[model samples]
Target chain A: LAKTTQPISMDSYEGQEVNITCSHNNIATNDYITWYQQFPSQGPRFIIQGYKTKVTNEVASLFIPADRKSSTLSLPRVSLSDTAVYYCLVVPHSSASKIIFGSGTRLSIRP
Target chain B: GAGVSQSPRYKVAKRGQDVALRCDPISGHVSLFWYQQALGQGPEFLTYFQNEAQLDKSGLPSDRFFAERPEGSVSTLKIQRTQQEDSAVYLCASSLGAGQVNTEAFFGQGTRLTVV
Candidate 1:
């Protein structure tokens, strides 16, 4: 598994755009970058996933540079409900690979 | 039925006791996973099951921990001689296909275990 490093915590206000970056210097060629959001007392929800370039969904956008050494999760027009712990995981393309979640970046949304 | 479900949302156990946690994955899901999450920390992998086979169990913390997925639908995690360090949330997740695919894994609310 590739180890990921992210900010311990971040603060933002309502209606603002929040960008969280994750650094995975030793990412493997077969690894894929995935982002998950976990609210208090709940399971982590999949936010977005991208192998390279950019991938966008209704909720967020993932930008992977050409080197694929890092990725960024961009959330547009964030609200108070966006407050949660975000995890960046690099998983191998294997049938039985397990996910190892590290201490994620906690995003606190202020009113 | 609609999503992954876990039983005994909260459990309080005494040290040296045994406990069982159950997980019900989504219908037709081929991959099931178990994870342990401590307070203020990210979830750690415990085990993985592909259909009725236990593909991986390397993440099991100790010999006291055991997990089984009989018949491939429902699964149970058993811990013998539980200790205070065993107190944490046990989460279960299921995906429609193998991990090599682009499938998303859905997670249950998880069972919060407290060892006193």
Candidate 2:
């Protein structure tokens, strides 16, 4: 399992774009970068995922550089409801691999 | 299409009491996982089951914790002799495939366990 480092918290105003970066220096070749968002008392929801380059979806976009050592989760036009804890996970492409959830970045969107 | 679902959304137990948390995964999902999340912290893996077989349980915290998926659909996590430190949210998730990249997990509302 690869350990990930991210900011403990981040604050952004409504209508502004927020980008959270995660560092996984020991990321393996078969590892995929994925992001999840969790609100209070609710289950974590999948935001986006990518292996390399940029992958955009209706909810968010993931940008992975060529080295795959780091990835960025970009949330466009944030709102107060967008406030939640965002987790970045690197999971292997094998069957029944362990899923480790590290400390996530708490995103606070101010109105 | 229903996502994962858990029972007893909130559970309060006394010290030394036993508790059972249930989870119903999505229909036809091959992989189901159990996780424990402390207050203000991310979730930690507890165990995993592929169909009715428990393939991995290394993440289980202690011997007092046990989980089973006998029918391969509905699962239960049993905690014996609960302690105050056992307070946390127990989450259940299911995915279409057993491989990581092949499928993404769909989580349930989770059971909030409070030991007093």
For model 2, residues B18-103, the per-residue Cα lDDT tens digits are: 99999999999989999999999999999999999999999899999999999999999999999998999999999889866847
Which 10 consecutive residues of model 1 chain A have the lowest summed lDDT? Answer: A91-100
For candidate 2, give the lDDT of residue B14: 96
Model 2 lDDT per residue over A1-111, tens place: 899999999999999999999999999999999898999999888888889999999999999999999999999999999999999999888887767888899999887
Candidates' RMSD to native:
0.7, 0.9
Residue pairs clashing in model 1 are none
TM-score of each: 0.99, 0.98
Report how large a share of the reference interface contacts model 1 reproduces: 0.75
DockQ, per model, reads: 0.79, 0.80
Q: Is the docking of candidate 1 incorrect, acceptable, medium or high quality?
A: medium
Once superposed on the true structure, which residue ranges of model 2 sit more than 4 Å away at CA? none
What level of docking quality does candidate 2 show? high
Candidate 1 to truth, TM: 0.99
